[model samples]
Target: MYGGGYVFCEPDVHGQPDDPERLAEFEARIDRGEKIEPQDWMPYEYRRQLIRLIEQHAHSEIMGALPEGAWITRAPGFKRKLALIAKVQDEVGHAQLLYSAAETLGKSRADMVNDLLSGKSKYSNVFNYPAKTWADVTVIGFLIDAAAIVNQVANSKGSYGPYCRALERICYEESFHLKQGYDAFVALATGTKRQREMLQDAINRWYRPIIHFFGPPDNESVHSKQLMRWKVKMASNDEMRNQFLDAYVPKVLELGLTFPDPELRKDPQTGRWHYGDPDWAEFYRVINGDGPCNAERLSARRLAEENGRWIRQAIMNPQQKFTIPFA
Candidate 1:
């Protein structure tokens, strides 16, 4: 499950627009609830934005697997280990599904890999943080996975057929992921005092990143207007974040867990949650590759890529090199 909701991009451009007639038809189709297929003509920016959104989603699934995968061997019991292994496997499969979806936009999987490695593309910032304990794994799997569901379920209705379809499948598996995570979490919270403390400590550490999961609010982010209008973004960052808080905060509170932020509460007047600042500066810094475990995570990914390169070379055309078509 992925959590970083902000799609970091350069400032919006008002360059030459797409052919008015074609663009009108494209948007009208979206308005009429028509799904845009791979062969359908689309505006250049539509393709670019979809590629960016889907490619980063694909990368997040892959990178998000690493944290919990690391805990498989260290899980409490054989049953837990088996479950963790299966969950991690599902995540990797989700990545493959997403990459295939993104490939429909004319970016090869190879090109996507290069972009991720070169930092031209990014995964969710939440994955860069270390999972320090078994409790941390449950929080990542339960709360973080829950956050991803909120994001993906909203986007599952987006205009792009392939991405929406991929998210459909991913969301199904993710529900199971969330269930197992909640099971583990409840087990910890209801167990011995030490177990409770461990879970509580994890909750405290994760609360900030949890808020950052949905990125900046509507006013602070520059990504909304066009993409939202096109159905590329089904919900605003604040909308998704509020949805998550409304759904999950009560569950944690019922378990007697506490968020570190005293300012986190519902505004009775507006029915919206108000929260302390999650340090947007820190979120930006982490997304830019300065987080606690960013280097180590990428290093692990690079090692896998480097080691697997020969096998990849063996299976492919000797001289086939992929590049981003639009760029």
Candidate 2:
């Protein structure tokens, strides 16, 4: 058992088991609370599935900084600026943790980073959008962080020991992120008329992206069954999305911010919030590299990499370093 209530299980190896009875015994052992260590035998598919999910998660954390990183210098006050800086730093730390987790699955971090930078991998769709204003940063902290909390909370019980432990640490940090944004939203809501207006506009812009962050519904989508059956994901995308709506919509209304959905309302009988569906086409477009700031974000990342390439080379190969004359 981990973190008091959840269990991490060893994945049953497929086909390599000696017999059907052995496979059943292995699965039965998993049904218990045993933890899956790195050296333990696991199905090839299980390793591949986890690599896919955790690598995407790491990439998301790294690229996720771009949207809010743009607003760091523009924060309204020194305190807010510092907070955003720390928050973005924490996101970078999350990337390190997740990438390390993925490394335990028999791949190198350098390879994963190369795949992400070269566009051979996908990150979260939410990061592709633009953070247009200072208010947009607050909204991102609140909504995006909140959605991640739901997913991370579910992942805290993951079968992989390292991933689950990393998620536990990440969840604690994310809670603080959520609270900081909540405080910011409350301050703006009670501030002058202009502040309120800006906050509302930010809410309008980020709501759809946050909703889409959960990805498409969990019907017959690709990778759904494999991920779910292998316990890589503990909750369905739509289920987690609904859980986010359940927690956040009322808080948004309490702050006098509209959710940008006219048909949104709570069902008296079932206690579930219902709203008009989001535009999946826009979600596809954004994930397909067509969002408002996709080009700018990628260019910034690429330029940073290129400008720092020499330093990386120097570190890896100190004897081959260039000798420059005094400036």
| TM-score leader | 1
Once all C-alphas are superposed, what RMSD does model 2 give against the true structure?
7.0
- The TM-score values for the models, in the order shown, are 0.94, 0.88
lDDT tens digits by residue: candidate 2, 1-327: 001111122445552434556446545555685656676666566677687778888888888888878888888888888888999999989998888888888778878888887877778877778888878888888877888888888987867888888898899888778988888878888899999999998888887887688877667645566556556668877788788889988888987778788988878898766767888889888777888877776788788789999988777855563332111
- Residue ranges of candidate 2 with Cα displaced over 4 Å: 1-26, 220-226, 317-327
Reference-based lDDT, each prediction? 0.88, 0.76
For candidate 1, lDDT tens digit of each residue in 128-247? Answer: 888999999999989999999999999899999998898899989888899999999999999999999999999998998889888877864445677877899888888999999999
TM-score of predicted structure 1: 0.94
RMSD (Cα, Å) for all candidates, in order, is: 2.6, 7.0
